[model samples]
Target: MLPQHDRRNSREVFIGNVPMGGNNPVRLQTMTKTDTRDVQATLKQCRQALDAGADYIRISVPDVASVKAFEKIKNKLAGDGYRSPLIADIHYRHDLAIMMAGIADKLRINPANFGWPPESKKKQAKKSGKSEIPPGLLAETLAPLAEACKKHGTAIRLGGNAGSVEHTNTLTKTRSAEFLVNQAVKYLDILEELGFYDLVVSLKNSNPAETTEATRLMHQRMQQTGQHYPLHIGVTESGLGVSGRVSSALGIIPLLREGIADTIRVSLTEEPEKEIHFAQKLLDVCRQNGDNVFEATCRDNMLYIISRTSDPDTLIAEAVQGFLTLPERNAIQHITIEAPGMANQQVVKETAAQIMQQADIKEVGTRFISCPACARTSTDMEKLCRLFRKELADYPGIHIAIMGCMVNGPGEMAGADYGVIATSNDKVNVYAEGVCIKRNICGKEAISLIREILIEDDSGR
Candidate 1:
């Protein structure tokens, strides 16, 4: 459960009817891995994701065939009653973006690719002995695309990848948080100059730490410069299975805890449906926590309360507010309200009606056990441990120990399915089923290794 933290206010961008940022629910997104040109396969995946609770879906539109397929996929889904927003993920092809502007609910462009000097500009730069494209020309090239987006009411995600930095002069470095921030700011300047405000920012890298730092840096800069654009945070190439899930969580959960990101994608090398599930669960854990709220989970039943007050009417009202905040509200069969004194029956009935009216539970999930960081710890052990516990809470056979010490102290990690020991240098050693399987792994890798071991063992059983 996330401690009810204040959300960072950001500019809201609408994708279809769903609102993102500005205290709106942290939206869930997943990209289809199927060949975009295969309309049947892509439509199948998109429908599967929407059924799994994906707020928005993204599909690559890299070539002309993919564009046509996207159009078919969109029409088919709309025909079948899938009204969730569809995003066109375009790379380097501004023409495709312009073409997709009228079709897609959102257009996600790789800023580094969009900013890269085209062949003509490159040849001119070579002739002039210049290392970069002239700023005016780059802006001119992007303006038409931006204008197209505005005319079509298509939101844009200015996505920056670490791998793309080497190809563009906007940033000459990779894995550096500063470079990531600069790259995003450069493209943001272009959009702002053309009066484009329907934008979100994403800075992604394979390294979880780099991803976190870059996002935090970008969020800080946005706050400082009075830029409220929503941020989309994720780690690129976050692997597969348990390893990918944990690494993605390590990178993403911290910024989310800080209320720095508005939407998240766990870029796992797995089925796109799994990514949606992970991101939705993470958001559920982040949005609903406070001392005034209480949740008790035992087996399939749950007991929840909205307390920290003395008035019966206030207690009932708070309880309704708390219940409505949960993503799993309807899944809960029975809710018992606790008050300091006898509550009014009328108030209870009205509040219950309001909750039932607003409640739309998605699925059953888990509890959280998070701690604060200490000087002795490496990585954000607190966030990692919380996610570890939450992800594996359903497995009663698995016992996990998240220890910050480099060595076992006072028999704290015995009889555990997994044991993690943190070092002074932000590295962790993983012990699986009572034996060491991997060591000297960074925090990002530690979660994945731990998850991988658990999944392997569970499969064996």
Candidate 2:
């Protein structure tokens, strides 16, 4: 049995009829990848996620059309007898977020872009050398959204991404855990000043270590400010397949064990239902009572993870749970998995290495960062990501990103050494060290080009 720990005492906040935090079970959420304008398709994906045990479903509301479509999708779900809460994922436009506040059960707005000045005003501010938003102007911009949310009884999530923080606040000009926390807290403070207390917070980074660190700091900062709003924890752009799962586990499990996360989403580069399923498995391993299904032992700086079940997913979850919750994780220099009934020791070893690598304790192979392709994506992102992974398997220590679209791709994958972002169904922008080196190249040709870049880089080294 794992040692018992107390959950952070967050105040209960309701999303539609569902309550999160304050002794509520850790909630699971997933977002629809379908276009919001495709009401039927979006509704279908929402139903799939709900059926898979998600407590909340988020749909991207990228533009005015999507906002209208989201309203239709919400009504359709209601007409079909589904009562699960729907969250509107809004970016770039505070007006869209304000519009969503009246319609969605929850509005997820990025703090980096939520109340920032428009480009014209931004240029003016730059000329005047004003780095911070004046208090009155900030209130003027956000007050309407706050009032709208309050009128509709909708909760707001001030989600900060490490990838985009540099674009907004001068205080967050350098992207670090402390800077991320500072940016989020500034927004939270303004929201509180506006008398909007129904809030959830999230700080995500593509790097698992940064995500973990930033969230931990956010929790502490909230406590200091006497803000007990629930936390929604996730690692953005966790990629696809086992790499995605391991990365999610590494970033999330430790926080879950520490009792910091009130709700969680595992952002995988696949169908929404897959994310829900993976979250279920992850939650099972990190239940609040601290009664894990696996046993762990450590000797001579080597930790051995043992499980009775032969199921690979369960074993991986157990290993993650066992490794992350250790009191002296840094003291353990190695990990060995013992699943005698399982025939493939190689799988076990690989799983262990992945866990270690994702935790930032070791670097076993190449790192992949990918986003859950949303309606904004133009290409077959899942297929492309798999192909890239298969082709780039031998480049250990290199970080590559397979982003679905240009919207958040370049920013979210800022840490990747090399990356590709789809500009259209057939064309992509290739990136090296966060700078776009090639634009609008054929998607098929991008793979070879990246390989050549990698080979050239290696040879130069």
Candidate 3:
């Protein structure tokens, strides 16, 4: 069993009829991948998430039309007897966010881009040589939305993405854990000043270690300030398949073991229901109070883990939990796993390596990162990602990103050596070293294009 820690003291906040934080069990959430403009498809996806035991269903509302569709989807779900809360994922427009506040049970806004300076304002600032946004501007911009949320009994999540956060200090090129926590704290202070306490905060990074570090720091900062707002924790753009699951586990299990996360989502490049399933399993593994399922023996620099359970999934979860919660995790250089009667021990060993790599404790092979495709995505992300993996398997140590859409794709994949993002249903944009090299090419041709680019780069072209 994982070491138990006391749950953080947080004020209860209700999203629709669901209560989060405080003493309530950790909640699970997943976002729909269907286009929000298609009410039936969106609703159908929401039902799948709910049926998979998600406490909340989030829908991407990128525009005015999506907002309308979101309302229709909400109404249809309610009419059909689904009472799960619906959250609106808003990135750029504060106006749409305000509109969503009145309709959605919760509004998730990126502190980096929400209420960003308009083009007119930017032009004026450029001409006036006063580019700095005036002090109190964020509060002024968010007050209306806060009031609307208050009136509608809706909660707000100040979601900070490591990829999109604007750095005030150009000296720091990378978005560090300190920077992420500072951003979230800034937003928390603003919302508190506005007297909006029904809040949730999340700081996500594509890197699971960074995500975990940022979350722990955020929790510490909040505790120091006596701010007990709930936290929504997840590793954003965690890709797909076993690697994705391992990444999610590495990022989340540590927090859950420490009783830090009040709610969680396992972002995966697959069906929303699959995300729910993995999340549930994660919770089960981390929250167990029974006898430990793993027996570990350390020899010099390597740790050997033997599982009491023969079940593969449970064994993987147990191994992850056992390895991560170790006090001497940093001292260990390698991990090996054994399960009695297990036909393939190689799978378990591979999973152990993945867990270590995902946690940033070791480097195994090629690094793959991809977003959990949302409504903004237009291509078959799962298929494309699989193709990229299969065709590029020989190129170890390289970082490749297969993103779903351009909204946050380019930014999220900033660390990747190469990336492919779907710009439309049939077209994609390819990137090298964060610069787009090809635009609007057929999706079917992206892998070949990437292969050619890789070959050229190998030749020092």
Best by lDDT: 2
Q: What is the C-alpha lDDT profile of model 3 across 1-461, one tens digit per residue?
A: 22324688878999999999988889999999888998988888899989999999999999999999999998899999999999999987877888998899999998766744555654554465543344376677778988999999999998888887754322233588998788788878888899999999999998888999999999999999999999999999888877888888889988888898899999999989989988887887876743346787777868888887655556666778877767788788888888875666766877887877777777787789888888888777888788777777666668888888877887788888888888875688998888889898875587788888778888994
Which 10 residues in a row give candidate 1 its minimum summed lDDT?
A: 363-372
Report the Cα lDDT for residue 340, model 1.
40
lDDT of each: 0.67, 0.83, 0.83
User: Candidate 2 at 238: error in angstroms?
Assistant: 1.1
List, in order, the clash count of every candidate structure: 2, 0, 1
Model 3 per-residue lDDT at 109: 90
Q: TM-score for every candidate vs. truth?
A: 0.62, 0.93, 0.92
Over the stretch 1-461, how does candidate 1's per-residue lDDT look in tens digits?
A: 23335678889899877878875877889988676776887888899989998989998887888888888998999899988899998767777899999999999987656764557765675587544446677688789988999999999999887645524332233447888788788778888999998999999865566788899899899989898899999877544433345446667767887888788887754567878877765565455532234443323445456354444323433454455455564577666555444345544443343333223222122212111122223355545565565456565434455665542211234334566676657677777644677877876687777667667877997
Better of 2 and 3 by TM-score: 2
Using TM-score, give the best candidate's number.
2
Better of 1 and 2 by TM-score: 2
Model 3 residue runs over 4 Å out of place are 1-5, 117-119, 122-132, 167-174, 289-292, 308-313, 340-349, 459-461
RMSD of every candidate to native, in Å, equals 14.9, 2.7, 2.9
Backbone clashes, candidate 1: 2
Model 1, 153: alpha-carbon shift in Å? 0.8
Worst 10 residues of 3 by lDDT: 165-174
